[model samples]
Target: MTSFSANLGFLWADRSLPAAIRAARANGFDAVECHWPYETPVLDVKAALEETGFKMLGLNTRRGDVSKGENGLAALPEREDEARAAIDEAIDYANRTDTAAIHVMAGKASGPKAQATFLKNLDYAVTRTSRTILIEPLNRHDAPGYFLKNTTQARDIITKLAAPNLKLMFDCYHVARNEGDVLFRLQDLLPIVGHIQIASVPDRRAPDHGELHYPTVFSKIADLGWKKPIGAEYKPVSATEEGLDWMNSHLC
Candidate 1:
């Protein structure tokens, strides 16, 4: 059977992190993931996870200043100190929350300088913790000027680093948008994928809609022998509960 992790960042936008974790448990999700939980008290989040018995599959490093439209710090040449600090903070949070991975966000900067900085930050990140460290490839459409925008680039970086702890965050929605061949890409890149996330393409809604056939995709993921939780990181078309009809249908 395919396992799903409710992305608390999207599912219960109006609720507190603890409440969102409780809701994910109630809603039949196998686990939960977060984009950023630094705003919440770690103990409170930890208590909720303990009570609910749901593992937080992963979370993200900070996105720097939202006011400045900074998507991440790791890839910015000038923000190396801040990037390292964000990594440390994420590691500390993951340790406290029992998260298995951290998606290190690469900010909206590109070029040799940015790449060098990202590699440096990644090198720093890998030595700090035993947990998986993920680098996601955001689509250019959604994240213009983003430093990391494709799986090929991410895969190459992972191969170059050769750090067992460093891996790719394969977000299907972004991949589908930027690369088009979701199943083929999934198969080709499964080796380096530390985590997988999903949403409908073009619309970024529930996986049941849009061009991607999620049932087939889910089956493909299973066939690939992926044991990690697949994150449902989509915006709800309606209320969170109401948009889960597709998931309910697949619960056999």
Candidate 2:
């Protein structure tokens, strides 16, 4: 069976967090994943987990103070301290929530100075973070001038860092837009990929409305024997549960 992670961030954009959890549990999903569950009270999320019987598949640090115009902090030279603080906070959250993975935001842009700071940050984190850290590369369109815009860049940094805990977050929608041959890339990059995500090419909607054929993609995943979560990170065109029917049928 294909285990889908209910992305509460996008799917339940309008609904309250508790309502979204109830909807997902009622839909008979195997599991659930959330985006930035840290924004709300941790105890509320814990209560939801107990009620839904959902296993948290992923977690993430902050994207900096939104009004202050900061997107990421990990790669900025001057803001290394801020990035470290974010990582620590995220680690603590994961430990508290017992979530399996964490995405480190590649904060504001920087030059060689920033790259140096990023390496230092990773090195510092490897010793502290006992759990997994997935380095996400967001699309340039959505995240203008962001430090990490593609998986290849993330792969390179992880290779240099040489930490077993550090790995790539292979988001198909962003990768399909920024680069091609995603399947082959997955084959080549499988060793370093810790998690996966999916959505439409241009619209970032449900997989059923996308140009990509998940049947082929899911088959490839089965063949690869990737024993991890493939995050369903897309906006639903209609009711969230209705949108997932197509994916459920195809995954089987």
Candidate 3:
């Protein structure tokens, strides 16, 4: 049976990180992941995971200077120092929390310079630790200027880097939006995929609410031999707990 990871970044976002972790456990999620949890104390997060026995699956490097519309630092050519700092911070946090992966955000950038910067930052990240390092392709609709725009780009970078620890974060919603044929893409990229996340395409809400029927998607994933807990990275339309009929129906 396939398991699920509650993406605390969106689900139970109104609660504290630790509280969200506990809530995920109470709600039957098998694991958890987050976007950025730098503001929360590491011990508190660790305690919650220990208390709940739910593995903290992954987290992302800080998006530098959000006020300036900076989504991430890794791919910004002139901000190499800040990008490396974010990587270091993420590594420290991941180690402290026993997290399995880190999504190194590429920020809003393009062209050769940005690609070089991202490659450099990714090299730095992989060398620092053996943990899986992920690069996700954000759809243009949600992140217009994001450096990583599609799986092909991400795959090319990963292939060039040739780091065993480096891998792709294949988010089904983004794939549907940016490339279409989500199942074909998932099959083609499964070897390089480190983690998988899902949400309703176009709407970014719970999987059951949109065009992509997750039961079919999940079935394809299982047939492909993917055993890790797929991340539920969607914005809840109502209180998170109230909208869990999707999980129950799908899991059954």
Per-prediction TM-score to the true structure, in the order listed: 0.98, 0.93, 0.98
Order of the predicted models by lDDT, top scorer first: 3, 1, 2
lDDT of candidate model 2 versus the reference: 0.79
* Top of the candidates by lDDT: 3
What lDDT is reached at residue 161 by model 3?
99
Give the Cα lDDT of each candidate.
0.92, 0.79, 0.95
Residue-level lDDT of model 1, residues 1-252, one tens digit each, is 788999999999889999999999999899999999999999999999999998999999999999999999999998999999999999999999999999999999989999999999999999999999999999989999999989999998999999999999999999999989999999999889888999998899988878998888988999899877789999996789988887889731
RMSD of 1: 1.0
- After superposition, which runs of candidate 1 have C-alpha atoms over 4 Å from their true positions? none
Give one digit per residue, the lDDT tens place, for model 2 in 155-185. Answer: 8899998999998889888888778677888
Candidate 3: Cα lDDT at 132: 97
- lDDT score for residue 214 of model 3: 82
Candidate that scores best on TM-score: 3
- Native-referenced Cα lDDT, model 1: 0.92
Give per-residue CA lDDT, model 3, range 1-252, as digits (tens).
889999999999999999999999999899999999999999999999999998888999999899989899999999999999999999999999999999999999999999999999999999999999999999999998999999999999999999999999999999999999999999999999999999998899988867787889999999999999999999999899999888887542
